[model samples]
Target: MIIALTATTQLGGIAWLIGRPFRQSLLVSLASYAVLSISAIWVAPAFGRTPLSCVPEKGGAHAGIIFCVTNRHYVTPELKSALNDIVDDLNTSFPGIQLGVLDASFPFLNDFPMLPHLSHNDGRKADLAFFYKDSDGRPLPGGTLRSPIGYFAYETGRSACPATRFDLHWDLNWLQRVWSKHELDIDRTSKLIEAATANPRIRKVFLEPHLQKRLDVNHPKVRFQGCYAARHDDHIHLQL
Candidate 1:
């Protein structure tokens, strides 16, 4: 009876989270943590949980040949749809190119779990690695930190603005923490950002303001969130 009651409570909490606004999910997340501490009924989180629902089977790579990075792999249905359609569009814009998903969707039933991110609580955002190219300037293939060894970074002392210095000296601390490589192909990166902004479904893009100026991304949807988080010099974050 006790175990059954706990499971029922967990299910109800999850249902409340899914039906309510995103902001309200924080309460459910906190409650889940508390329950996990006390109840033998608690189980490890489901891999396929999104803000909408926890479908353990729907998480991860799914039917598509999409490459996902890290545990932040729970993909939302809407994001999945957009990605499937945009793959060909990105390929057409830059031939021989594929995408690297840094983060997407969220873990099952825990919208407010303790994560490094601030807004990834719901299944509405995705972060992608910048398109890379070889030294010869040809579009390169997508790779993880291990497979192809894509390493790129910025040197310090560059002037992004007169008042403030740029976040240079490519620090691998974040990458090391997440086990991601910093191999960004700058030229193609810019083009990829441009191509991404062309999609109407991609609501907004977060990039370095100066980098935006350098790329000349005149799209209204492209925005610079300042250097509060690391500069957008390394990856492109897309919101749908």
Candidate 2:
């Protein structure tokens, strides 16, 4: 039959192809298979299906524990890992500090007019608020919290620097209060700065001179965990 002859020809052609160089053919076949397998592993997710049962939700708290915020549409695995490390470090540094993400969501960044250039839009930045509770064990609203013990002011005003004038768009009173209340003395803040600087991922930490002065001379018991670049004065922005 024609089908039988066709099958014979196909088998014969394959046998000839394989016999030409057995070792090379086997290696080439294996390499092709590996490529296909890897492609399948990485490509399936893009098509809207995932192998894992639990996928991380975007721009929200996970497990009522750690919170996340990103400006980008998707979060890279590297960023997620780095954020996890930071959260772990914070928990170790301050026990029972309830973690939450600030985005275009609830009380923090959501609905608030953000500063133009100072806003955390690159998905690499975040603002963290200290968690506080009342005697009834209920979360105290951020507005109710006392300001940190420090005062913040620009050392030099630059007409060219829009971020230096960030007070025009953002309300940093709450953040200033938090830092003022919680900032540690200079010696302790220095230790925290040292630890953050030692990390390869952290580029820099900028503290307002006035804020630093307050921590150094004015009040005690306040400790700074870390800080970002100068542009982050309007908000506590974290880069990963």
Best by TM-score: 1
Off by over 4 Å in 2: 1-75, 104-115, 130-198, 215-234
- Residue 199 local lDDT, model 1: 71
Q: What is the lDDT of candidate 1?
A: 0.50
Give one digit per residue, the lDDT tens place, for model 1 in 142-221. Answer: 53322232223422223243333344323454454443333446666666676668777789898766667666777888
TM-scores for all candidates: the values are 0.56, 0.36
RMSD of each: 11.0, 19.4
Over 50-90, each residue of candidate 2 has an lDDT whose tens digit, in order, gives 22111234322221111111111222344344445554554
